[model samples]
Target: MERRPAPSRGTAVRATRQGDAVSAALAETDAFTSAQDLHARLRAQGAAVGLTTVYRHLQVLADRGEVDMIRRDDGETVYRRCASDDHHHHLVCRSCGRTVEIAGPEIEAWTAKVANAEGFVDVVHTVEIYGTCTICAARPAT
Candidate 1:
């Protein structure tokens, strides 16, 4: 097994702050965020944290399964804390960078149906839908 690096003093500080910030941030917004974006936004929102600290904290949270880092088609990894204890999917707005949470039993049923029909067993699915959001659509062209 690979060994993990020892946590530095800064890392420890960030870890504590990140936990608090992540909780507060999630409570305040419905949008998904990447480390870079979160760093910028948090700073703008007066968090007084650095970019490196944000990235490190994000990695730690992701490793612990406390947050999900989703890599978009453009290669940016966005993160969102899991809000529910059950399985769910997301609808992402490409234009406004918004995300919607969705959950239903019908999705589970359909996944079982399709997987069995295709002769596959023990399958899992994660669905993400992307489209323009209302805010983006209503905005004037640049």
Candidate 2:
């Protein structure tokens, strides 16, 4: 479990307070969710937050590294809780839009080695492995 980056000062304060509806909403959700979906969930939770607020909160979280903001192939931004330990990656299911977390020090080392071999420094990698999820695999093909 890769440790998530720390929340911003603003978010930190909010997550500590009951009325910090935005932070509370985010905290209650699964690791992977869209900001729009999160806004809907917050509304359903009786939080007085708006889509704009959700977006802003998500930006702050992203800046602080508490979350991962990914761009799907279709150009949608998705968010997920950054796990603990700083040693994880994602296994994304293309069919069902689900994501799984995976971690291995060897993978990280390999990435570093590849980057170094290519004369790349401080390289940031985004690796999305696409496949059908178990649910999708188990279901009868349409």
Candidate 3:
């Protein structure tokens, strides 16, 4: 994994109230939530943040490696607060939108070997597996 530069002290101190609110909201859940949904949640909590501010803060957090963004099958982008500092991947449930964090040493080795074989340097990769969870799969057809 490529290391990102630590945020400057000034940058850390300059975090806005809206950004803090957004971060607090995100930290409350492990689900991949859309910006609209997050805005609604903030409003429910009596926060005065707007949808645009939520999106902007989320973008900054994603860029800073503090959050992860993934696309659903419907093409909507969702954001989640990453729980781990070490490298990992997500196993996402298609029906319920539940996510599980997983680490595979073999997958890491394979990725590095493939990248080296292709003469690629400083390679980074993302892997997300999607399937129905047991509970979802066991449900009867509506």
Candidate 4:
């Protein structure tokens, strides 16, 4: 078993088969996926994992900043494997769910400036841009 150091605040996550299964399933997809959908897929594959476990583990991973999370317009939350460890945003294809991780230095500077001007500290932010990707744009509309 490969061991990693504990995260900040003295919290440790023990490795488990179900957690490994969730990570593996997530890594298999390039698109963001709902936890319920991922749970169903794992059950279909005979992963022997429960929905609650999936949710719990995903929250842990998200809190650790090991995954990217976004909320759809209809309020559905989704998760995807992070492509880069550095601070970045996401460009998502609305029709196809394809996602690209990107960095926006200008946005970062703007946010910092705004926050600091208001005397805010410890500011955190997330930005996700959704639009049709090239392939989706090329397809004929139904």
Q: Enumerate clash totals for all models, in the order shown.
A: 0, 8, 0, 0
- Between 2 and 4, whose lDDT is larger? 4
Task: Rank all candidate structures by their lDDT, best first, as comma-separated numbers.
Answer: 4, 3, 1, 2
- Model 2: per-residue lDDT, tens digit, 1-142? 2233344553342342222566666666444678888888878877777787788778777787777778877788988775553757788777766777777667788899999999999787766667888988999978
Top TM-score: which candidate number? 4
Clashing pairs in 2: 1-84, 2-83, 2-84, 2-85, 2-86, 3-84, 3-85, 3-86
lDDT of 3 by residue, 28-57 (tens): 887788999999999999999999999988
Task: Summing lDDT over every window of 10 consecutive residues in candidate 4, give the lowest-scoring window.
Answer: 1-10
| lDDT score at residue 58, model 2, on the 0-100 scale | 80
The Cα error of candidate 3 at residue 117, in Å, is 1.6
| lDDT: worst 10-residue window of model 1 | 1-10
TM-score of 3: 0.84
Residue 19 in model 4: lDDT: 90
- Number of the candidate with higher TM-score, 1 or 4: 4
lDDT tens digits, residues 48-99, model 4? 9999999977887887778888899989999999889999999999998999
**Every candidate's lDDT:** 0.73, 0.71, 0.84, 0.90
Local lDDT at 37 for model 3: 92
Name the lDDT value of residue 34 in candidate 1. 75
Q: Candidate order by TM-score, highest to lowest?
A: 4, 3, 2, 1
**Candidate 4 Cα outliers beyond 4 Å, as residue runs:** 1-13
